[model samples]
Each structure stands twice: as structure tokens, then as C-alpha cells.
Target: MASTGERDGTGGTDGAETAAGTAAAPAERKASWRLVGPGIVVAATGVGAGDLVATLVAGSRFGYTLLWAAVVGCLVKIALAEATGRWHLATGRTIFDGWRSLGAWTTAYFAVYVTVWGFVYGAAAMSSSALPLVALFPGALGLKTWAILCGLAGLAFVWFNRYAVVEKIMMVFVGVMFVVVLYVAVRVTPHLGDAVTGLLPVLPDGSLLYTLGLVGGVGGTITMAAYGYWVNAKGWTDSGWMRMMRLDNRVAYLTTGVFVVAMLIVGAELLHAAGTAIGSGDQGLLDLGRILEERFGAVTAKLFLIGFLAASFSSLVGVWHGVSLLFADFVERTRAARAQGTGGEPPVLEVARGQRERSWPFRGYLLWLTFPPMGLLWLDQPFGLVIAYGVLGAFFMPFLAGTLLWLLNSGRTPRQWRNGPLSNVMLAAAGLLFVVLCVQQVRELPW
Candidate 1:
């Protein structure tokens, strides 16, 4: 049952519950910080099939010439996520709380981002998830029909479950994704010499945009901002959890790095070697599936399809669960700040922490992610929304990178937990890179 909370006339939860319930909840975890779960959830969420497809296209075109960029992408994400998680652990406040402290501009950017980004992303995620299903059980259902089913399935899972169940299930899917991708990568017999030489920092001609995309796109998602919430969900709210959080963030990106490299290998050795071309987006994975069947056998093709399904669906549900929690926290934080009238300072509203998963805003956002987007699954996405999504999506990483630098460096964070020199350098570079990518995305849009 949803816990009854103090609500004003407008029906938003008034403040983050400052009661003992929120604090004690973290203590109930028996071996809480010892196990690695949130990182797996993040890895599963961030590295969706679309991301892998982009990596595959890179390999098919450049044949590992951009391999160094992929490695750097992983490192960059580690720094960003570490800074995010650090803010939560070091300050005992949610990221939204920190954002509230930064002034109203942060709020305006996030509000626009989650609203437009969530709707278009829901449809795309469901379509991507359904693609592998349609391939696996070809005549079982039509594409739109499968897409709706996928969306509903994700909705039901996230709606009924809490963080732990979500984490465990995501971990299983991550395992499936890892094994199948690795098998395909190894089966292709990648040239060791080329793989080694590809690690050098040389870019082939005409590959600048692709190189930028590779660096900015790997394992990066809106989910990175949600890492702190996931950490708090695991009952790791204080600086004591900082060590484990850093390790967790590293493991998350390491897993992602492996996924990126393995997919690139499949593209380099299989598609590139054969001089084969595949359609782009999730469809590219389908093209690869057909090739696997023709060359290897039915079993190999089916296994690849299964991995594809796992990758897509894991991302679908991970976003469903994680982002809703983010939205809930977003709502809760905004309401609390207004009630406190913090005069644009960090609201001292961190006392009673309610379970964001059980909050109305969280469930409402889950529904927002699920049902409304199904209309797009049937009809094509409205061209304007698509354009808006692309534009806003382009802006998000830069927004996140820029904000983390701001929040983690200023008085908003405790002095001890502030970003170090290396973190600053990595984040600034990430910010600059994303800004470049954002401009490219806008230029390519059909304005």
C-alpha cells in the first residue's frame, strides 16, 4: 500500500519524509553495501541495443580505428557517475535536492528534459525491445502488437516491484546480454593484431563525427543521473558508503566497456570482414541476426536473437523503474523546496525520506512511460515530438556534465566531497565533447 504522507491542497507530497522511517530503512539491509547490484542495474539500463547498434555501425565502417574512443567513453562515464554518486554519499541528499540548491535554471532544464525525453523515449524503447521479439517469434504477432505488449510488460514489472527486485532481474538480463555478445564476438575470430593496433589514437578520414558519437554515446544515459537514487535505494546514504560507491561505479562502466568492445568486435570481424552492410538502429541488429543464421546455423542466430531481446528489454524496464524514481524524487524535491521557501538555497528538507517508489509521482511517471507512448507505437511518432526529442536529447548529456561540475564543486557539496582535479578535467572534457555532439545532432535535424 502507498504510505499516506502529508499533502497540501495541490496533492504533491509536501516534503521528503524527515521521520526515522527513511533513515532506518537503509539500516535494514543485512549485507547491503557489500554486494554489487546498483551498478549492474545501471549497466543494464545504459547500454541498450540502440547504443550497441551505433557501436556496430562504427566497427563495420572503421574496423576498430575508433577503438580508443570507445575506451575513453567508458572512462568518462566512470568519472561522471562517480561524481554523481559521490554527491549523494557525501551529502546524504538526493541529486534533485542538490539540483534544487543550484538555483531555478537547473529545475527548468530537468523539467523540460524528463517530460519530452520520457515520452518519445518510451516508444523508442518499446520498439527496440519488440524488434528482437518479432525476430524470435516471427509470426506470433505484428510489430505494433509486440511493442504494446513489451511496454505493458515493463509497466507491470516496475509498477508492482521495488528497487531490489528490479536490480536482481536486471542483473540476470545483464548476464544474458554479456554471455551472448561475448560468444558472438569470440566466434567471429577477431584479428588480435588489428584489435591491438586499433587501440592507438588515430582517426580515419571522414570519421570525426562517428568518433565523437562513439566517445559520447557509450554507456551514457539519463540513467547516470539516477545512480545516486539507486545508491540511496540500496541503503547507502552516508559517506561511509563512498568507497563502495566508487567501486560500484567503476564496475558498472567496466561491464559497459566490455559490451562496447565485444559488439565492435562482431562488427569488425564479421560484418567488416565480409564487406556486409546492415540497416541502422535496432534494425541493424536484426540484419546481423540474419547473417548469423546464414553463416553459423539456426542455434547461433536464435541465441543472438535472445541476447538482443535481453538487451532491449532490460533497458526498457531499467528505465521504467529507474527514471520513475528519478521523476518522483524530482517532484518531491521541487515541492519541498517551495514549501521551505529556501530563497534559492538548498532546502533543508532532507530529514524524513519517504519511499519514492511508492509515491504517487513515481507511479504516475511509470504510467506516463508506459501507456501514452503506445499510441506512437501504432502511429508514427509525430515529427515535431521527434524533433523535440532529438534536440532535447542532444542537450541532456551536456546538461548533466555541466551541472555535475557545478554542483560538486560549489558550496552545495561539502568541501571534503568536492570534485578533485582529475574529476574536474574529465568532466570538463566530457562537457566539451557533448556540446560538440549536441551541435552535430541539431545540424543533422530536419529543421
Candidate 2:
């Protein structure tokens, strides 16, 4: 995939020595269509079992009325991911670096946020992945045992592998899960007419707050911020790759849209029609599995469980690699800022260019994500920490959206690459939407 730089005859050495948080542009080559990646990584990482459950619940309560919301959610994420990749390629900086450049406040919040969020999330991810395994094996191992094993496997896989290996595995897992969900959606024999109408914007009675979560709250988690890091890891560090990045970003969310739509269809046809209720989280998928077994037989149920495993494990490994990469970049940017503060030179070594996977920060965060959260699996998550995590996690999307708006519009970005009118509108809308969700979530949290 030749970048725009290569095509335009201005390739700027492929992000060789770009600094962490500087306003620099690494010359790029024009993007080739066939070499798209990173999107899969973001997509796989974004659509965890929790997300699927949310979509399923939306379907169960309202049928296809909120299908439009699912599609809009995909569009919102597409804009966010595109802006993220654009910031990285247009200005040769990592997302963490961009956030740092805005001020110390961004970094401080992120430090606390990632630390708390990762500890809680690691436990959640492991347990989510472990759910299917326990169901399929029928008591071969306890939930905590399976959860620990899942966490360790993800840690090991990401610890030794590079971005290329990670992307390929993500593609395979996402691909399999998509097919599985699509098959189930088909098997359920959805109300085709209702689904078509669902494409139109319409909200059912009393589905406001609950539906609003799906309506505007679709941009997954920190993985969206990690999109840029993954882009650099793909070796597309200049504006030349902008076209490919946009296309790749679109493909990512479209795949996500299809996945969730299929789940909604299953919930609408299989569960909603009979007024069936399922658990609201990972156990939700297990409930669906039980229903599938009772209705369709063991084979179908097992297949769905396998799909659940794939979806969960892909997220586990993706976070292990992607977020660790982000944290590594964070450490690099922080150290560089400190050096500059002390009248020393901050390092010019950019992420993804110097084998960042081998870096200490990356490995440290990986272990931090893997081993530290195991305790939460054995015991109840502390109420105070959970509340803190809830608040931080809720506010992160808005923080990211607001900062992207600031960084992309300011002098930090080149004149030619600055946010256009459409970009501004979309980003502003995203920021406001996230703020509303944040307020709602905080209000609901058990403070």
C-alpha cells in the first residue's frame, strides 16, 4: 500500500525520528487499498461482550425501533476513530502526546484513569472471556480459574508478539464471530419488514434514557484512543496514509455495525417475541446460549458459545497489546516532558518505530493489566474503587472528544490538515453527547 507521499513523491522517511508530542508531520505515501489494517484491531477491541449485550437488550425491549441508533453509533465511532488516525498521521505524534501537549491536566487524568480503569477492566475482560469456556465445558473449571487462565493467555500472546501478529489474530477472531452472529441472526428468521423500518429514526415509549445509552453512547472505550497508536504500528505515519486510514476506519465500524445488528435481530426475533429476558451482561450471552440449546439443540448453542469466546478473547488480547502500547507512549511522553522541563532533551524516539513492544512501559502496563486484576476476580470489586472507575470511565470519552477538538483545530495541526466544517460539527456533537452520558452515568453510580 503505497502512501500519498510515495505517490506524490514526498515520502518523509516513514516516521523514523518523529518526537512523541511535537507538532511535526512525517511525510507519507499514498495509501493502497489492499493493505488496510488497524481498523480490525480497533473493531475487535471495541466490541466486547458487554457491548453486544447492550445491543441485545436494546433489541429485546424495543424490537427494531432503535436500529437506527446502532447505525448512528457506528457512525459516531467512525468519526472518532478517523479523527484519531488523522491527528496521528497529519501530525507526527501519538494520541497520548497530543493529550499531553494540551496540558498536564490531560496527562494527570489519564494516569489515574488508565491505572484504575485497567485494574477493573482486566478482571472484567477475563471473566467475560471465561464465561463461555465454563458454559461449554460444563464445570471443567471454575469461573475464577478460567478467568485467570484467559488473562494469562492474553498476556503471553501480546507479550511476545508484534502489531502484525496481533492484527492478524484479531482479524481471524472478529471474522469468525461476525459469521457466527450472522448465522444466528439468519437462523432466528428476523422480522425483515420491521428491520427495514428500524433503519428509520424512531424511539419507543419510555425508551428514552435506556435507549439513549445506545443512541449516543456507542463509541466503545479507550481502544478508540488507541486507534492512532495502532495506525502508527501499521507503519502509516504520514498524511499520505490519510485516505487509507479513513477507509480502514469505515470498514472497522461497518463490521461492528453488522455484528451488533445481527445480535439485535436475534434478540428481537428469538427473545423479544416470546417476552424472554436474559442477563444484562456476559451472563446475558450465556442465557442466550441456554435458550439456543433449548430451542435449536446443543450444536447451535455450542457454536454461539464459541463465537462468544472469540469475541471476548479478541478483546482481551487487543487490550493487552493496544492499551499497553498507549501506556508505553504515555510514559515516553511524560519522561520527555520531564527532561525538557529540566533543561534536558526529551527523547525523539517515536512509538512503533523503535520496537515499542519491547519497551519497559509497554511490558509493565501489560503485566499491570493482567496480573493485578486477578484479585478482583476472587473478591467483589470494592464499592469505592468501582465508583471511581465508573466516573473515570464515563468521563474519558468526553475528555478524548473534547481534546481531539482542541488539538485538531489549534496550531498544533497544519493549516491544510485542520478540522474541516464537517469534522468540527461531528466532533462537537460527539463531545456534547459524551458529556450527557457522563452526567447520567455519574448520577447513576453508587457514590
Candidate 3:
């Protein structure tokens, strides 16, 4: 594949540097399609079942009124992902290492967040992924059994495979789910005027919170922090790949934007037009499938359910793998005495030690995500645990945005590859929005 600067014609400073750096490298002249990997897979995996349900709920409730918020969500994610990939490409450091540079506070925050978040998120993700499957194949394996099985399966997949293999699997599911969901939207034949109107920025009555939620939600999640890991895993080290990393980030989120817009179209045209109400949980999706069957046909409903399962399952795999790596990085860093003492560990520590190469934390977290969560699938998730999860989860996006802006623009990165004016502005806007959402979440929490 050609470097991003050559393809896009945007020869920024970083682009020129990358071009110069790769000047001596062999030019294989491979097709661009062959270069598709981690970025697209990560983007697809990041938009899990919750994102889809949230978008559908927004559409069902507000029609296309919040379409701009969804678009904003996509743009914010692009900025975040680009920063992450750029950090890895420019500094040859993962996000975990980048965070450590800011201060011990960042590492401390992540240590606590990843442990608790992983526990609660494991059960939630498994249960959500299992819902559509259970609906389609009731009593085949029981809900909890299926959830545990799904988690284990994901663990196994990520444990044995390298980045390229994982990317291929994710891409297949992305293709399947995208086609299925987009086809459903096309079948709805939505209103062009209302969708166009949604593209404009307007806040309707009693929709302040919902609008904010849509803007902040869309495809935002902890996996946004995992982009650096994906970039590293794709062999995109050094400043030479910075331009490609940015392009990868942009393309990933652009695809995500289209996927989300299509879903909003379905919600606006199908459920909103009929005045139908979806339920409050994953089962609500099954309810949607039934509605689709009644209105359109059984095939349509089955296809939709299949797409839902694919989305949820792909996210299950992603969280099981991506978050586990984050957890491993956190553990390895925090346990290092130098890291604890200095308020930041050396990036060379991560590169040289390669603790993840032979670490139990990596596999242990994977097992934790697969097996322990099954109990929660059987029993109710504790309210206290849920509250903690909510609070910590709410803080991650803002934390990520804030740190990216601080690090990328600071002396830690090469000045030539640091955040330009546009990137800084976008990151600032994302940080502000996420801060507002975090505050709203904290205030509304049941303390």
C-alpha cells in the first residue's frame, strides 16, 4: 500500500517526515486493500451491542433529531483514535506508556478502573452478546451457559492468534453485520428530509440529556485507548507510519459513521414512524426482531438478529482481548517500583522488558473475563459494583482525551509530529463534551 501522504495528497509536516523516513524502504507496490487491518477491526469491534441499542433507542425516541450528535460522536472518536495511533507511530510507545509519562495519577486511575471495569463489563458484554442468540436458539444451551461459552471462545481466539489473524476474523464479521444492518435500513426507505434535518444542530425540548448521551455514546468506549496497541501490533512503529496511522484512524471512524447513520435511519423510519416502543434491555432487540417479522418478513427479522449477534459477539472478542492487554500493561507498570516512585515509567521499560511476552496477567485477565463473569450472568449484578462501574466508565473517555491533548502537544513527542491546530481544537472539543457527560453521569448516579 502507498503511504497515506501519497494517496491523500495532504503533505503535512508529519507526512513529509514519513515520506523521507520510508524513502529507503523497499517499495512493493502492493494493492491498498492488502493494508487493511487493525484500524478497521478495532473500529468495528469498538461499536458493540450497547452502541447499537443506544442508537436505536435514540432514533425510536427522537427520530432523526439527534443525528448530528451521532455524527459528532464519530468525529470525536476519530480524533481520539488518531491521537492514539499517532502516539504509537511517532513515539513507538503504547497508550499505557504515554499515560505513565503524564504522571502517576494516570496510572493509578487506570489500575483501579481496569480491574473493576473488566469484572462488571465482562458479564455485561457476555449477557448482551448472548441475548440475540438465545432468542434465536432458545434452550439450546441456556443463557448463562451460552454467555460463558461465548466469552471462553473469544478468549481462546485472541490467545492463540496474532494481529493479522484477529483482524481478518473481525473484518469478516464487520462485513456480515454491516451488510445485514444497512440492508435493513435501505428496506425501511427513510424520509430524506428528516435525515437531512438531523444533520443540522438543534436541541429539542426535554432532550438535553438524551442529546448529550447520543453525542457522547455512539462508538465511544475504553477500546478507544486500545488503538495504540492495535497500531503496535500491526508493525506500525516509528514516525514513518504516522501518516498511515492518521489515515487509518480517519477511515475506521468514517466507516463507523456510515454504520451508525444507517442504524439511525432504520430507527427513524421503522419504529419511530409506527410509534413502536423497544424494551429497556438486550431483549428489546429481540422485540425489535419480532416487530420486523410482523411488519416485513421472517427472513428480514432473522437477518437482523444475526447482525445483532455478530456485532455483540465481535465486541465480546474485542473487549476480552483489548482490555486484557490494557490490564496487563497496567499491572506490569504499577508493579514496577520505578514507575510508582517517579510518577511515570520509562517507555523503554515497556519496549525492553516485554513483560507481556511471558506474563500471567495477560492470560489471567482473559480467564477472568471468560469464567468468573458467568456467575454474574446467573446472578444479578450488585448495585454497588454497577455504580462503581458507571462512575469509572464515565471518566475514561475524558481522561483519554485530556491526556492525549497533553501528551501529543507536549515535548514528549517530536514537535514536527505533535498536534497541529486542527487536531488540538478537535481534541479540546471532545474533552469538553466528555467532561460534561461524566459530570451528568456522576450526578445521576445512585450514591
Candidate 4:
């Protein structure tokens, strides 16, 4: 039986009950803030070292002119994340289960993508997380040694912890990251007038590509597809949680917007004002740290380095936990399909009771993300693997958007939960935007 509070006018509950429940809307919205874990985890996980570097680079080149693009990026991601969460709560099914319903091809694509993407990403994420630590303690160990230690630490942490524990840890890291980044933003003193003006759309000369990148890349990744799993992990497993999930989704992007805006301010005031260029990749953050030390002092620089580590390590553990949960679901569904011999269509498996955190498939992917990637720390990343990673990454957002457009508007979803006109427009825009961005990324890749 659906609760009166959850059934809106459009939902197919008793009309009298929905009319009577309208008065409680205010209280439910007010209480939604307390149920905000999955969004924070998703936002924190999405804004890793790469996002910081990209925003910094944008600030370095264009100052506040591209601020609107970052804001747009957050809005776009909010739509994606909201759609993902809505699916889980509305349908009472995992994302993998939805993908399986699409076809075996979806499963095949994910199988290849996750395996390759994780292998390469594991090494990159470990390396990114290691940079700040290596910078902070130069006398302690080599970068590779630090990277291995970081990977193993994340593995052990996620291996032993459940979703509640993981969410709490991620929140602590997000808090540290928020404060440090906000301090840097204030310390540099952004130009209020120009930043406000940036809210209006204006693409500066020679900034078209960077503007598009900022718009498309502020806070997005494969981790977004894992969002529904995180929501499930948090035990929000029914349509009754739909409104709460949407509120949580809004908070997630709002938090992400704040983080990116702060970074843009730091970039505009610190890097642009000084006319300094930082190197690309995670090392770019290190370059910025050195610049901060020169401009301020060692203590300030160390604080920034600590924040960088927080950002990187949060992403590290997030994937270790969130993606591991996704892989665990995939494994469980695959086994269930085999056991029932249900060709490609498996029964919908409820996520509320799975021991996902301790499952072997979960541990196996965690090990895959930890151990094998360490080898890439010593050896050059194979050219083929790098290309594959780039290609797969390019298509992911559009894939997500296109699929959501199909799933959310169809009979697969309940009529009340179907995509409205506004959602349809947003999903369409996201799909087209990402498709264009995907072409640019592929064209720019050194093939």
C-alpha cells in the first residue's frame, strides 16, 4: 500500500487521500535534508583531482568569463543524478537490473567498459591520490610507494566497511575539502561584479573548447551511474522515498556547484591574476600548490595540499565502495540469470538485503582496482589502454542520458513517475550536449 504522503495528484492513489496529504508537503520537504547521503557521496566522488585541474586551467586562461559553464555543468549533472536516483526509488530495482532489461548487449558493453575503465582508472586515481601525500612528505617514500600504499589503504578501508561507514567517512573528507577550497577562494578575493556577470552566457575568443569542456566536465563520470546503487545502499528502496531522494539530489549538485565555483574563484584571483600556467593532470595541482606557497607561505600551501589529498582520497574510496557495489550487483544478477536459465531477462533482484559490501565479486573488483593498477605506476600506461579509456569515457554521459530518456518515459516506469516535459527537455539537452562533447574528445585524442 502506497502511503498517502507519497502519492501526488498525478500518482494513481486515492484522490481523497492525495488531497488530504497535500498539507503535509511542507513538513516532508523540511525533513528531506536529513536523508542526504547518496547525493553527497556522488558529488564528492565526481569532483576528483581532474575536476580541480580542469577548473584551475579554465580560470588560468579565461578568468571569470567561463564561470557560467561550470554552473551549467552542475545543472546538467543534477539532471543525470536525479534521473538515476528516481529510477531506483520509483522502480524498486537496481540500475544493472534496468540495463539487463534493455538487452544482453548492454551487459556486454558494461562488462568490457568496467573492466577496462577500472584497470586504467585504478592506476590514475591511485597516482592522483598519491601526489599530495608525496608532496607533503617528500622524505617518506617515492611516488610509486605512496601510490601503492594509498591503493591498499582504500582497499582495506572499503573491504571492511559497510555503506553507512563509507558514507560517514566520505562526508568527513567533503567537509575538509569544502573548508580548504572556500578558504583559498576567500583568500584570493574574487571579483564579485565579474562573477555575477559571468552568469550571463558569453564565450570568449579562443575559449570555445575550454568553455565546452568546463560545461561538460565540472562534475560527471561513470560514478554517476553508480548513484542509484548508493541510494539503494542507503536503504532508500521504494517509491515512498522518491521526494526525499529528489531533495537529496538537489543538495548534492548544490554542494558540487559551491565547490566548483570556489575553485573558479581561486583560479581567477590566484592563477589568472598572476598570469601563471600550471601543468596538466594531478601534477597541475602540485604546481598550483607551489605557487600558493610562493604567494602566501609554507603553511598555507600545506593546507591546500591537505585539501587536495582529501579530494583525491575521497574519490579513491568512493569508487572502491560505490563501483564495487555496482560490480557486486552485476555478478549477483548474472548468477541468478544462470540459475534460472532466463536468457537475458532476469527477475528484478531487490537490493535491500544483499551482503554486497562483503561479497567476493565486490572484493574481486576492489582487488582488481588496487593491485593490478600498481603495476602501471612503474611502467608506462599502454597506449591502447589509454585510448580505450578515453573512448569509453567520452560516450558514457550520452549513453546515460539517452537511456534515461528511454527508460523514464516508457511503460517500464509507472505513469506518475514518467518524465515530464521539463525532464524530457533536460534529458534531450544533456544527450545532445554530451554527444557533441564526445565528438570533440575523440577528435582531440591522440590516436
After superposition on all CA atoms, what RMSD does each candidate show versus the true structure?
Answer: 5.1, 4.8, 5.7, 5.1
- Which segments of model 2 are wrong by more than 4 Å? 1-33, 342-347, 351-354
Local accuracy of candidate 1 as per-residue lDDT tens digits, 215-269: 9997789998888878877767676677787888888789999999999999898
Q: List the candidates' TM-scores in order.
A: 0.91, 0.92, 0.89, 0.92
Clashing pairs in 4: none
Q: Alpha carbon lDDT of residue 328, candidate 2?
A: 84
Residue-by-residue lDDT tens digits, candidate 4, 1-447: 121111111112212222223322222233367778989998899999999999989988889888999888888888899998887666555677667656688788888889998999999999999999999998899888899999999999998878888899999999999899998888887889989987888988999888878877866888898898888777666666778888888898888898989988888889898888899988999998999999889988999999999999999999988888888878878777777673543343433344777789999999999999888988998989888988888988888898888777765566667789988998899899999999998887889
After superposition, the stretches of candidate 4 with alpha carbons farther than 4 Å from their true spots are 1-30, 342-354
Candidates 1 and 4: which is better by TM-score?
4
| lDDT by residue for model 2 (340-391), tens | 5645344454333536789999999999999989999878999999899999
lDDT of 3 by residue, 177-215 (tens): 889988999999988898999999988887888788777
* Candidate 1 Cα deviation (angstroms), residue 296: 0.5
Query: All candidates' lDDT scores?
Result: 0.82, 0.83, 0.77, 0.82
